[model samples]
Target chain A: MSFSHVAIIGLGLLGGSIGLAVRAELPGTKTTGYDADPDVRARARERGLADTVLDDPAEAVRGADLVILCVPVGAMGEAARAIEPGLSADTVISDVGSSKRSITDALVAALPNHQIIPAHPVAGTENSGPDAGFATLFHQRWCIVTPPAGADAEKVASLVDFWESLGALVETMDAEHHDLVLAVTSHIPHLIAYTIVGTASDLEDVTRSEVIKYSAGGFRDFTRIAASDPTMWRDVFLNNKDAVLEMLDRFLTDLALMREAIRAGDGEMMHDTFSRTRAIRRSIVALGQDDPRPDFGRADHE
Target chain B: MSFSHVAIIGLGLLGGSIGLAVRAELPGTKTTGYDADPDVRARARERGLADTVLDDPAEAVRGADLVILCVPVGAMGEAARAIEPGLSADTVISDVGSSKRSITDALVAALPNHQIIPAHPVAGTENSGPDAGFATLFHQRWCIVTPPAGADAEKVASLVDFWESLGALVETMDAEHHDLVLAVTSHIPHLIAYTIVGTASDLEDVTRSEVIKYSAGGFRDFTRIAASDPTMWRDVFLNNKDAVLEMLDRFLTDLALMREAIRAGDGEMMHDTFSRTRAIRRSIVALGQDDPRPDFGRADHE
Candidate 1:
């Protein structure tokens, strides 16, 4: 029950990467792609992002057995609707949205008769658009599948196998829990990064050039996350509002406590929390989520 | 005016790197190193971190024309006091503390009769200790030197020349201004990173494994910064209390506004801030403060 013909409805970073990865790792499968922007479509064609790059979503999905919506979360419903005229009755529908709950609801509302499975391949660089993706984008990364209740087991299994074939490790979880996990892991971190970078840029006392010059000490890391596509992140915050707000509350509580500790000059409390946080980083590196070499091994780039 | 024999008290990342960088870049100068922990001293000796790795701080400083304290900010005074017995009267004293004001005061108070200049080379990785140092650690990085008002120009110029010889681009700034700039650039970013990583780890609903598994979305970057040496960061926040608190207040204010924007579903505000922040990352890359490659160019390791 493997997917032989796949239609990617957005030829951006994730979509284009999927096309490239399928070609690189799952060479037997065929990929068709379409983008709303003609410029992106032309660029995707130039880069051979898909086997057949089409001008319309309906045209792209005509003979495909699977369709993956790779647009922003806020556009999931419209994108799902666009392919409805050409989607086969048995075609498995899925999307790569950062927030699963809203996208799941949107997809179901748009295509109630289709088999919709929402998945988030937790991988990317700060760059975006067609040129930002590479064949190895999903390598060694996690792809969380949030299949709705009563989804066909065979279809879901095939989808899992499809992602695994592209070098991603797959895990299945409920949409609500997926939303909560990602809100903690992705949404709130991005929001906090954007906020801090904004704060640094707006300071009257410290010039922006100084911040840029001295960024290697720490601030540069935050800027990378903050430089993500503004539209995608804006939709993420809007779509996953509940879980994001909940996580933000927890972050604020912890930040206030730290502020108090610093204000009181409580070195012990600061050290305790800072020391406790080291274990998670070690676990992340040990589990292969990140590079173990110093400075993410960038020192050797030259 | 140049330092012929240099003594580095505290053979951790910065001290060890200074020794290695001096050996690589300034072959004529001799470096003597000491660490408080005997285990670190042993490792430094095996690594040949200095020309002579002494077991005692007092022994390390004998007949040295320049002695640099590279201990944590809180330990600067005691490290200075330890070398008092062996310090030559003409030797120039300096330190590599992140926060300049408090370290400058501590060094001056501990060695009132010596020429004291405080410096901060804005460079490091999350990993610390003697094993983390490399000869190119300070290559193309900024070294901020803060000299007191009455300090000799010859001594200050020589200190600048020394840092330049070690591959750092040197800049002179007042101690208080140095604290303010670093509070915005380095200290506050580390505090926010520690706070966010702690917030994610302590969530009762989200298991730690889940957070670690899906960290690639953005949280992993924060964890790296948060994983930095706790004792050094604790002292940094404590020593630069006023500037850090001021910067934290600004960050909190901006964060609250972002929270309000998210709560209100104001996509435009979120987009505007997120988009504006990209310029800083570009400038940092343009200035060579960070690697411009995607994901810090870490993908090649596997």
Candidate 2:
């Protein structure tokens, strides 16, 4: 709690919110934020996202006790390279990037002797930038840490405690396992959403217009998923290509079977499949992953 | 708005909700409801979904000024045939089914002597049955009317007024066009969601478990979609096969292009498609089809 300073790299929602959460949740914690965009830096300072906002990563991290990277996955390497020059030997460096293996490698090479603990907080909205940050973005969400064996145990413990204080359920695993699990869980799903929405976008102008108009059905869901930060998702697919491609292969195989069922007018097959998927929703509700409101949008039902 | 007698057939969410909405919105309306299941009718009356509930659909339609058929699309014909005998010659008969083409056709044949105006309220949640009745589910949603040309204008006008009072934006079109529009809008989208969730459900145990656990990423959205009423969706596909197939053709072509792009590692194609889809989302927000909440999780964001 007495840490002299916590530096947040990239004044996007994740970084800005972490700064805000640390400020409010861990009062007396001195915070500084850095971003390549000077406008974002100014906004962060104006919004009191941090006690200090600076253009240079080194300026933000200099003499800081902890440095947290919260940039797009593709930017992690460059961010680490830029911050390495000023990172102290004992600074606990962590990240909220989606990919773990690639980021951990970049940080290790950038700051050879510094204590680095790669982490990913599985909480976010499609929105981006400093102004979108909130004080409780990570509340009740999961945060996974992929620390290499023999890494500084005290730093790992402190990082876990930090996320826990922000209402995150902290878990630890290796980089490869994290990538594989997330491939099925997140990457492939996002890609499919992007693919479907992209499909609808390519329709004739009239058809596309109607699609947007009547999107309240199911296409709107895909659009919401498709609207996620493209650069971040692009990097996710590229960085996690192996796991993504594997998951996609399985998905395609299953989708092919479903297409066949529909083509053959196999109601039994369709009904059974639809029914099985319903159980996962029940489990999701049980796990408190859903809104818990029975009729989410149709509150009149109550 | 004193409706002396209002009869709602089928006793599901739509039927029960019609009773609920009308009772609350149009005062002094004596509502009656009927379902094949005696227990459902008993509960409907007990819960005040209707002032009177009957097991026989014909009995419920007796002495009623309005008779609403609220059964699943596939069952509409049978319900129409069964209740035709009891429908008064001057009764304004309508339906709350999803697909309009088939329902309108069934009503034309089965209730030729009665005034039938097919209606579909474009609002509902995953939950169903009498217990799921709500007084305001139609608020701010659309209620599309597919009245046969030269049908009694007074009856249509009265129905429109009733729906408007229930908070629906009423629009009228031919049943064919309605089917086509909803095919692209709702039916095909539901089919795709069911297919994708089916695909996920077929994954190996490890991947399947991971899918449910990490569904928050994007797949969960599809699951919520796929979790919709299977009977209703199945009938929608069968009833609106032509339009659904047309939309499916377009979607499949688009998906094939995307599949090839991913297979060939066409990064530019992926990036361009993703960027294009984002505009549709902006349009949906502009149309107020979506709540501009950064995330579509039904949460009120500040």
Candidate 3:
């Protein structure tokens, strides 16, 4: 059973995109949107981000069959609590948070009686806000649905069907495993990007201008990742702390080995490491998970 | 004086791009190319990578007024020595090596009497080989020229003019400084990417399939960088050891601080670090060094 009425809390990139995607892909589905910030609600109304833009979260969720909270992970509990007054007994509660386990726990605690199934669309741009979202953001992207233990199979199927209708491939996993997987894939990459950009910015010998000017040499890619929404990433790292820290330590250990190889001039080891990675990239391109064109088919190169 | 005939010693991505760029942007400039591997030389000939693709490196450089060695950094000396017998007394020696100091020293030692000036074009896709190059690869990209101490100014100016003719913005600097700047901008970024890709691949808990499937979360960008030519990257690390290690240490230090912040749940610190990075991305976009479109304007999203 697909959701006919979807309510999105927090009208940022993810929320706005879901609204737009629903409008484009499932024209019959009604989307109601709300944000804590009044300015965002005003902007959401102007952009036609939903069928109805409400100032109050509870008002927005009223009459919705599915309520998807799109706020940062740290705010999931508060957002879940905000909509409790408006939630119907049959409405399925879910969130678009990077880390699923913590969000699942928070949502369960906040709405003890509601059906909670958290999911993360493994897609986004470096931009944020209502203006940064578009209909095709989820097209051909992976959306991992992390259901709590013994989650109602019907509700889980409904949520998966809803996402599939919006052009996302859905994968169901336990909340614990989802957090561990996304911790390596998303959280740690962001941490590394944020760190490198920070290091580049705080350099004493290399001027910031030089870093910016010669960025095409590879530094620009990190800048793009590092330019992601600060609040969202901050919360992702904080809430996904255990898994992120674990993945980060593994990455650091690998990096230390690389550093030693560099210091010792172990060219063969470096070459082998560099060469084996191309197969994974090839596989990703083959699977349509990434742009097959070189440099991601960036317009500047063309 | 503009180069009437330009000799490219390695017909790989950089070399082939130079040939094609010269053909497109400087129609009058003739290009002669050679690769040590017979297969690459044959492919370069078939692709019209240069006006003339020669079997012998010496034959390739004969009569050319400028010779650009585009081989891996470690092979620069051998490539320089190969063309020494055919180089005109007036031919200016340059290279497209990532590390300027090492390349400059190698070229000077190989052709002691010839004018050696190393320049690095901060441009490329995550691709290699003769077929991977295109005419506009250097358009609007920065070409940093690091001339040896007491190098003839006219030859340097001529080299700058040649690069400018190919639509590159040229900057002159000393070799040592160029190595330091590129360490942060290019070498270390590649190292981090290679290490992260390796780490993700070697993970026992997170299957390689999972890593590839969920790469769009952030890991795909690093995979692209890590998929870069292994031989070239290996040479970059070995040749620019001091500066790359220095920058890597700084990055590690910054990453440690971020790790601690995450462990301590310092949202403010993470937010502050993440926020400041956007400005650099903005500057890069403003300067047209990177694609301003979200996700580098990847076609997969559109």
Candidate 4:
């Protein structure tokens, strides 16, 4: 609430949603937005995604003390440099990228003068673009901040406070740890989803339609995950290849073991594996990350 | 409403939910239920899952015009045999088992006198037992009826009417076609989910905990599928082995191709695969299988 201005780069789901949350919860902090897509900027203006929409990133960040980049990992460096000239020396710059280390590295390289406090709000939808934002997107979600070592503690604290006001639980971890953790939690899982859905998409015409028709069983879940923004996910897998590959290796090895068990008709092994994963579902439900209540979205339910 | 009495055996989620749905939609049709587990039978009675609760399956089916067995596939034959002696000669019997061919064949062998219309209401949850049942579980879901080649057309039509009244779209396919269709739509997908989640569960403790902690990205979706009723799913894979194996073979072939692409760092291939699958998600969303608008359960901005 104390900050007079904030700059949001990219103006997509993350940026626009942050603008909405900041407006709803941060109060009177004039938000500015920048995106290469002129249509997104126009939509932002119509929807009041930000108080000011500008063509140049520098102009958007010119007077703001806080600048947030909410673009794909592949675009972070360019966005960072474009806004660097307008960012104040006291500005705390952050990003909502899936891979922490790559974006943090890029930010450090692109804007040396600004306080680069990398953040990843571990909450989002498969949808993208400015129109895909909402105020409650960050509520009860995890926000991981990987601050540059021994950097401005107060600036980092302020940014964390801002996220908290948006109802996110702030966590601070090193960039490598963040990437490794997300590899298991998000990256590898996303890759598998993309692959599985990809597998189904290649099915014969008749089978493919049947797959879509009766997908409610389980494949529907993978389809939702695979439908995420293609460019963002493509960059995530490429940028975090090592961590992704490591996690993928472990996953493949485990899958091989499962395949063997199934081949051998080892019901005990299958049952045990299923039972163990059920505990994970219980934990997630307990943590309230997933709604225990059933939701057949009216669009889908109808 | 015209049917004097209906009976459901095995009052788990399927039977109990069926009973509740019938009670809500089919006025004045007396229903009775039987469960092998007395505790479940008592819960079904207390919760008014049926108009009557009987310990003996035969006693429950004695006077009912319709006897629906909502039991595991492995037990369907035995259950059919147990209640056959008391079932009315004109009574139409059905079962809500996942695999139709195996159960239907068994029912024919066990209860030669009864007009068995093997049916499977293709809706479910990870939770089992009577307490997990609710009135709306089958609302707007599919119920596949694998009627025998020369079965009574009127009986089939009435059975279809019964499910339609309970808010299901009834699709009557032959047993073999139903098995093949379900192998692609349900069984193979479940196997992959179980395999992937099983793999994650076998990871090192640190990564394992991290997987559970941050499952919102994608893995949590698989967790729900993997957490399904293990015994029922196990029986499904076992009974529908040939069909499941064929689908699994195709899935593995596709997955291997993806693995090669990832290994070669072919961004174009990965992107192509992902982009194609997004269309399937769109179809599923369009077909009312899942929420297409900003997945991961984010409500509309409004």
Candidate 5:
């Protein structure tokens, strides 16, 4: 059955985007959302991010058939708990956390009576808050549904249909595997971007203004992501600690080998590694995951 | 006096772009080009990358008032030497190498009687070769001119005007300072991207297909840059070893601090660092170096 009433906890980018997308794509479904911060709640009301922007999570989830907690990964459990009082016993609970395993466990533990099928919509921009929500944020994006082992087939199908209506392609994977995949694809990339931007700013010899001016050379792409919602990313790195750390370790090892190759003037090795990575980009473009236009079709650059 | 004839050595992305840009923006200017690779020369000829695509660098430079060497950074000396036979003593010699210090030194040593001014058009796509070039590549990009001390003012001003005509903002700096600034902006960003892409592909737990499918998460941005011309990037690292290494060292140190913060659950540290970098992005967008559209204005993402 299609969801008639959907509740969203934590009305930030993902939460608010879901509300807006549902309003645009599934007009029959009513969206109720709550943010812990009053400023965000008022802004969400002004933007009509949801049909109803409630001040409390409990009030937001009342009478809802589906409740999606869209808070930072670390706060998933608390958000779920906050909605527990008003949530119906049969409500299917889900989330849009970057890392799935911990969130799934935390959610399942907090809402033992409800259907907790954690999902991560692998879509976003660097911007956040009520203003960042848009109807097309999930268009052509992937949303991985990491349903727990005993999830009901009908509920899973219904959730899939919900995301499909919002223009996201749906994939199913085990939560553990989801964490591992996203660790490489999302978490580590955010970390590296954050690290490099910090690195550029911290350099004493290179003026910060120079880094900003020449960022079009390559650094700007990283800054777009490094500027992402800090709290959300911080929670991602912390909650997905093992997977993110493991990926970071592998990245550091590979980087050290590259450093040695450069130091030894091993042009062939650097060239081979760089060449192999190019194919991955071609594959990403082929899969329609990225814009094939040069420099992502930036106007001035063209 | 304005240059009526311009010669380009190495008909790759940068060289062919200069030829095409001059043809489009300065229609009266005559362009001659050569590539050491006969296949690239033939392709350039087919594309009409220049008014004439000559077989030899010497022939290409004959009667040219300005000759710009656009070979790999490591090949700057050899490219300059090859054109020595036909290069006029009055012709201004310059190059489009990412690393300017070694290139300037090499060009000066190879053509002691000619004016050698090194330049780097801080613009490019990841793509390479004649097929990868277009006339508009340098529009609104920075073309840093790194002329050595005691360089002729008239020659530098003429070169600046030439670039300005083709739609690039020009800035003059010492070659050494240019190398250091680029080390922070471009070189280090590229090395980190290459390393992370390699690391992601090498993961034992995450499948490559999964990584490719979910690259929209942020890894896709790195792949675009990691997919850059390996030979050119290899040359850049080798030629600008000191500055690149210094920047790399600084990046690693900052990254180490970030890793520690993550490990210690220092959310405030990550939050502040990530927040500070947002200003840099704002400044870049304000300066019009990048398209301010979400997701770099990608069609699929839009």
Candidate 6:
């Protein structure tokens, strides 16, 4: 069964984008959105983020067939609990959290009677909040729908159908595997970007202005991801601690070897490593996962 | 004094770009280009990358008032030596290498009598070679000109004026400071991107296909830089070894602290660090060093 009414519990980039996408792609579906902050609710209404903007989370989800919590990963449990009173017994609950395992556990615990199917749409710009949402955010993006063990097959299919209707390619995976994959793909990259940007800014020898001025060399690429939402990333690291730490340790080990290679002036080893990484980039472009244009076509847009 | 005929050795991205930029922005200036690789020279000729594409490096620089060596950093000395037979006594020699001090020393040692000045245009796409260049590649980008101590001021002014004529903002500094600043801005950033991309690919648990598929989460940003010309990056790390090592150490220290915060569940630390990095991205945008649009406007183009 398709969701006739979808309730988005957070009116941020992901939530607002879902509301906008549903409206644009599925004209029959109605969207209701609510944010804990009243200012966001007002802005969402002004932007027409949903069919209706409600103040109370329960009121927003009252008659919704699908309730997707779009809060920070650490706040998923609280958001689920807030919408519990209004959720129907058959409402297929889901979330757009980066860490699947923790979000799945928290959501199941908070709404025991609801069918919780957590999913993460592997797409976003560096910007966030209500103003950052766009209808095409999920177009041509991957949305991993992670269902709990023994989840209702019909509901899972319905959730997948809903995401597909909004132009996302859905993949079903267990939460444990999803967390591990995302740790390597998402969390560690973010951590490294954050670390390097901080390192560049904190240098005594290189002034911040110089770093900003000459960033086009390569540093600006890191700054784009580094500017992502602080609260959301903080929760991602905290919620997916084990997987993040594991991936980070692996990355650190590899980085240490690279350091040694550079220190030893092993040009051959560095050249081999650098050359091997290019194939993956080509594959990413061939698979249509990233922009094929050089500099991500930034110069063209300018 | 302005150069009536400018010669570019090494018909790759930077050299081809300089040739095109001079042709587009300085109509009166004549351009001659040469590359050691016959294939690149053929391609550069087909693209009309310069007014003339010569097979011999010495022939290419014969009547030019200015000759810029645009080879990889490791080959600057040899490229300088190759063009020595054609150099006029008053020819102002310059280079576009990422590492300034080394290139300056290499150029000076190879051509002791020539007025050698090194400049790095902090601009490029990940893709390289002759076809990867464009006429507007240097538009609004910073071109750092590092003249050695006791260098002729008129020759330096000519070089700076030439870059400015091609729509670049020119800044003059000593070679040592230029190396240090770029080690933080360019070399280290590339080293980190190359390292992380390599790390993600080698993980047995996370298949290379999986990393490529889910790279949109953040890993894709690094891949753009990681996919940069491997030989060029290898030389960058080798030539700027001291500054790269020092900066890498600082980044490692900061990353370790972040690792502890993640392990300890210190959300506050992560939040503050993430928030602080946003300002740098904003400043970069304000200064026009990067594309201000989100996702570098990739989604819109799609």
Chain A TM-score of prediction number 1: 0.99
List the RMSD of every prediction in angstroms.
1.1, 2.7, 0.9, 2.4, 1.4, 1.0
Stretch of 10 with least lDDT, candidate 4 chain B: B293-302
lDDT (0 to 1) per candidate: 0.92, 0.78, 0.91, 0.81, 0.90, 0.91
Cα lDDT of model 4 by residue, B131-198, tens digit:
87888777767788889988988989889989998888788888887787787777877887787676
Predicted candidate 3 versus true structure: per-residue lDDT over B1-302, tens digit per residue: 77899999999899999999898988888899999999999999999999999989999999999999999999999999899889999999999999988888888888999999889999998999989999889999999998888888998999999999889999988888999999999988899898888898989998998898899999999988888999999999999999999999999888899989999999999999999988999999999998878899898777
Better of 2 and 6 by DockQ: 6
Off by over 4 Å in 4: A1-3, A295-302, B1-3, B205-209, B296-302
The numbered model that scores best in lDDT is 1
Off by over 4 Å in 3: none
Clashing pairs in 2: none
Clashes of each: 0, 0, 0, 0, 0, 0
Cα lDDT tens digits, model 1, A1-302, are 99999999998889999999999998899999999999999999999999999988899999899999999999999999899999999999998999998999999999999999889999988989999878888888999999999999999999999999989999999999999999989998899889989999999889998999898889999999899999999999999999999999989998899999999999999999999999999999999999988888885323
| Highest DockQ scorer | 3
Off by over 4 Å in 5: none
Better of 3 and 5 by lDDT: 3
Descending-lDDT candidate ranking: 1, 6, 3, 5, 4, 2
DockQ (C-alpha) of model 1? 0.78
Considering the two chains of model 2, state its CAPRI-style docking category.
Answer: medium
In candidate 2, residue B81 scores what lDDT? 86
Clashes of 4: 0
Which pairs clash inside model 6? none
